[model samples]
Target: MSTDPTRETPHDLEAVDRDDAYAQLVARYSAPERVAVALDKVKAEARRRAKARQLVTRARGGLLHNHTVREIARYFRKAERGRVDLLQVSEGTGIPLTDSRQVLREFVDAGLLYEYAEPVGKEVRRSYALAEGGKGGITEVFIETEAASRLEEQENRARGTLGWGEA
Candidate 1:
């Protein structure tokens, strides 16, 4: 009840002291758990943001269909490091080639698909695989010589003879 104009009122001082004390308590008690909880919240928010971005992209006429995306992702996931070209994926998933290409490009932009290159004849060919965690999205490009291609063709024929499924 001091009358000094410069002096903070008891209620004002109490409120600030209470806030500081609460902050100190939060920092000191269950600190690790609190940190983990905060981190989880941040990650969840980021995921929500990514989903929103996906939606917005679709709304903007970007061809971001959930069914198509899921089909493409599943196709690559099943491939499991094996590369598949666009035409093969399109045919397997029953999605048109144009739509498949757009979807695959979107997945690549979203960090959910990996694009790579392999040689076919004298020219290099582009292919794709599913991105896993943060490691699988990186493209692996290599040149395949004629001998290598011939060897691969022989292996592919051999696999065909054994009745293996294509990715």
Candidate 2:
């Protein structure tokens, strides 16, 4: 035999073919149920997180609305003896007159604000002020309490969903 090693080898090609076949067989028989279950769990967790975020946003909105209403009521209670019109309240609170009117209307409906209507064409303008019970009005307390309750409920739900205390 000639002493030469620069020749094509059949065993090298056969080994590569065997490796490919083994990989294909492993892929074809793999079980995917575990991956599917994990994916489902991830999706469910995402949905729960989204709902918790929505609750937080709603709670914050209620808190802000209650705080603003309280501020407006406090402003009126501290004003001079004379009545303050909606425009004056709006100017003092740095809120638009239209928004102030809306808040006034809500407070009036809720019995937290009292409205005084002057005679038509009278030089004196109509005005609004805190109701008879002043800052301790039932409506004001109700709004504040409701906001607080909602915030607490949201926090509890978030904590429970995130498994904060669960073993």
Candidate 3:
């Protein structure tokens, strides 16, 4: 029974101490039988890296640093409304898809990247390009348009209907 007199309740009998319950959970998952879960994660990451390397090899490009924002900017140097899918960026840059997406997002926020939706068939596909002024002078209209495009792309992504194209 709980020590509090006013809190009389039948469910109180089933309540376990928080610390004790946490320790039990830790012990349960730490058992040898559960160690495969950890190993499986490592193996999965290895497979992803191997696939990324294969893609880099197929693209005939050197692997860039994992998280270089400058490299991404440089990739868009000659782009004026250049159309590129997210998977192409991932393969060309040799960065993981999630990381490349994040860096692109940061570039978008910094006005170095211009994101827009290109109509592909019946659905709109997202793409990015370098701002016209070379990141020195981004117009207010460009910023607003890019911001709206990014928001709409995010919504499409969440809905899982927007295809990023061959990865």
Candidate 4:
């Protein structure tokens, strides 16, 4: 109980960092099982943060994320007409024209949208319509977090195939 202002006694509250205090308390008093559970919680939080960061990185790299795809679907569902063109989608969704076109083409390639050239007077206009249960298809669409390591992986090639029903 010495009253030295500049001295950091062992009992002083500010002498040790918060993390060191927690470590010392847990090590000395916590049971083994409780310590293991605490560690597991810490690891799960780290993984969750890492995954969120990875998703942000992927979106920044020009890859559309799950929420963006859902937003496009919502626009199509709420639009006056089922059939639309790239420009219409860009304006309706408020996404850039280039990004809208790219995402639509990706869906077309994935068989979610039916694309055709419509004759608008003398000039042809490209149009797209949602396939059967296109909203359902959009819901099923998943963004790849990582690229497949092997070129010969058939699963990677079959991107949007329907899930195999349970045996």
Candidate 5:
């Protein structure tokens, strides 16, 4: 039997005090055993969320990083002058397969590199090289800043001073 009107609904008992309930909860969780369990649960949840975030980030990624292309270019510069497989380049550069494929295609189209296949006893293995006739103008493109060089090359190509006009 409670005196508080809120507690004495129709023909009911006392209402629970929020502060008392909270204090009880705090005391229960403050115990070492409870604290350890709670901490472990929190840490586990954090790890799960972190893994989810990484997956979401990779899945949602739209634009390819220029640095990734630069890294792949550097890989090509150091690679042997023979063709290498897509998997080999991806593994060596630690770039994702999809990204490596796209970048390599772009590089080939841009003539920063060339792509071909060589017979591997029974099969042909696709490969790439940095030498576009002699060597790719990686430094020229990336060093001059991608945007500015693109603009410059556009003007130069139009004026018959570079790219297809050069040859």
Candidate 6:
């Protein structure tokens, strides 16, 4: 029984009214045990749906965010190993320097990148390389390749599902 008519199907509203009437009648004449069981069923169904929705959301977020981070880290590692500077990374990746720096920082924070200081005459210059456990210094290139491959696979699956061809 929603106040918004558009939200309440005719059948749904009828069911709600019928349920309300039954509840009033039960309170007046039915055994307390029957009412308690009915309420418990409703509560259990609501809990189940809520849990399902939460699980879906958590799964989606984990896939999207974790994949993005891993892919970005792989890109940075490849660029560093190739002797590409930050400017080159910005241009080649088509990500602005600021955003690229942020992504790189995350990899550093995650311990996927090793940071070191190269001493200059007056100031120290910081540089990065792949951490010992990572795929050496070629992580970025590998990640980019892997991501492209995955995307292609996804596209092919989608086309197959929809009866479409490569466009």
Q: Which parts of model 5 have CA positions greater than 4 angstroms off?
A: 1-63, 117-125, 141-167
**Candidates 3 and 6: which is better by lDDT?**
3
TM-score of each: 0.41, 0.40, 0.35, 0.41, 0.40, 0.35
lDDT of 1 by residue, 1-167 (tens): 44555666657766567679999988888898989998986675455446435533462343455456555655664546466888888988888988898877766666666788788999877687765442232211001122333455588888775322344
Clash number for each model = 0, 0, 0, 0, 1, 4
157, model 5: CA deviation in Å?
A: 38
Worst 10 residues of 6 by lDDT: 51-60
RMSD of each: 14.7, 22.6, 19.0, 17.1, 16.6, 21.0
Residue 20, model 4: lDDT of 92
- Give the candidate number with the greatest lDDT: 5
Candidate 5's residue-wise lDDT over 1-167, tens digit each?
Answer: 66666544544423446556888998887897887998986665455444323322332353445556655756766545577778888998888988898877766655556688889999877787764332324443343334433665788878878653346
Q: Which parts of model 6 have CA positions greater than 4 angstroms off?
A: 1-71, 76-84, 117-125, 136-167
lDDT of all predictions? 0.59, 0.58, 0.54, 0.59, 0.60, 0.54
**Native-to-model Cα distance after best TM-score fit, residue 64 in candidate 4, in Å:** 3.5
Which segments of candidate 1 are over 4 A away from where they belong? 1-63, 77-81, 118-124, 134-167
| Candidate 4: residue pairs that collide | none
3 or 4, greater by lDDT: 4
lDDT of 1 at 154: 82
Candidate 3, after superposition: displacement of residue 21 in Å?
A: 90
Range of the 10 consecutive residues with the lowest summed lDDT in candidate 5: 51-60
Error of 4 at 15 (Å): 99
Provide the lDDT at 111 for model 2.
Answer: 53
TM-score of 4: 0.41
Residue 35 deviation, candidate 2, in Å? 72
The residue-by-residue lDDT of candidate 6 on 1-167, one tens digit each, is 55665566657966678779999988877667888888986665455444323322332355323333444545664443733445555666666767666655555554455666677789765566665444432343344445655665688787775322335
Please tell me which model should have the higher lDDT, number 2 or number 5.
5
**Can you list the residue pairs that collide in candidate 1?**
none
